[model samples]
Target: MKRREAREKAVQTLFQLDRTEMSIDEAITYIIESPIDPFYERLVKGTVNHKEEIDKTLEDKLEHWSLERLPKIERTVLRLAVYELLFEDEIPHSVVLNEAVELCKRFGDEKSGRFVNGVLSKFEQK
Candidate 1:
């Protein structure tokens, strides 16, 4: 699968982790056992490892928006994108933002795609 698709899978799994309250080990094991690409597994693990920092960066960029107040899907998408933007130099910022917008359209609330785009755009400008 493509890296973008892999990222989407990671976002979905992270969102699942929030709902299921699965320990990192459990979530990692479940993802490993699934049909996900190995690249995706790596991305998911990296994001989870750096989630605290990523979320904090996200919170700072979002001004009044608390990470907790975001819908789970939107939160996960932002986490995944920010992780990529901050850590994965192989991927361009534009790619991360585009993939996040697509994932929001697919998995988030109706207004969420645009909301995500707006937030991510601000991050890109910095």
Candidate 2:
């Protein structure tokens, strides 16, 4: 799968895991139709594995908004982007940030892209 496709799937799977309390294995299977792609597996597992740290980082960076107070789509997109930013060293920071903004634009509300870009820029600066 293309990385963009993997990212979208990752966000969907993560959203499922968050909202339904589904197991990682179940979430992956539910979202991905083909045999498991390695990139997809890594994103979903990595995000799940590091969610606490990611959430803490996001909590600290968000202006006045708590992570929990964000909409579910925005929260899930941020979690996936943050996972890529912190864990996926093979991908450039700029690429990750750009992809995240694209994903937000596609999956979230009109302001999501800007909101995602602003939050991720803080990570890029760090």
Candidate 3:
């Protein structure tokens, strides 16, 4: 799968996991209709594995918004982008940022793309 598609899948899977109590594997299976790619698996697992730390980093960067208060789509997009920014060194930061903004535009509210861009810019500084 293309990295963008993988990122989309990862966001969907992560969003499902966030709303439910499903395990990562279960969440992936539940959402994915086709065979899974390694990149897809990696994004979901990596984001989930480091979620506590990622959330802490996000909470620090958010202006007045708690992570929980953010919409699910925005939160999921941020989690996936933050995972790539912090852990996946093979991908460029700009690419990660752009993809995140795209995901927000596609899935989140009207302001979500800018909100994601602003929040992720803070993470890039660290």
Q: Which ten residues in a row have the lowest lDDT in candidate 3?
A: 117-126
* lDDT (Cα atoms) of all candidates against the true structure: 0.80, 0.89, 0.90
Best by TM-score: 2
| Cα shift from native, residue 20, model 3 (Å) | 1.4
Say what the RMSD of model 2 is.
1.3
The estimated TM-scores of all candidates read 0.85, 0.94, 0.93
lDDT of 3 by residue, 35-120 (tens): 78999999999999999999998999999999989988999999999999999988888888899999987788669999999998
Give the C-alpha miss distance for residue 108 in model 2, angstroms. Answer: 1.0
- Residue 117 of model 1 has an lDDT of 81
lDDT of 1 by residue, 43-122 (tens): 78888889889988888889688988988888888888888888888887887788888888888765898888888887
Superposed on all Cα atoms, the candidates' RMSDs to the truth, in angstroms, are 2.3, 1.3, 1.5
What is the lDDT, from 0 to 100, of the residue 86 in candidate 1? 87
Clashing pairs in 3: none
Error of 2 at 75 (Å): 0.7
Name the candidate, 1 or 2, with the larger TM-score value. Answer: 2
Query: Which lDDT value does model 1 have at 64?
Result: 80
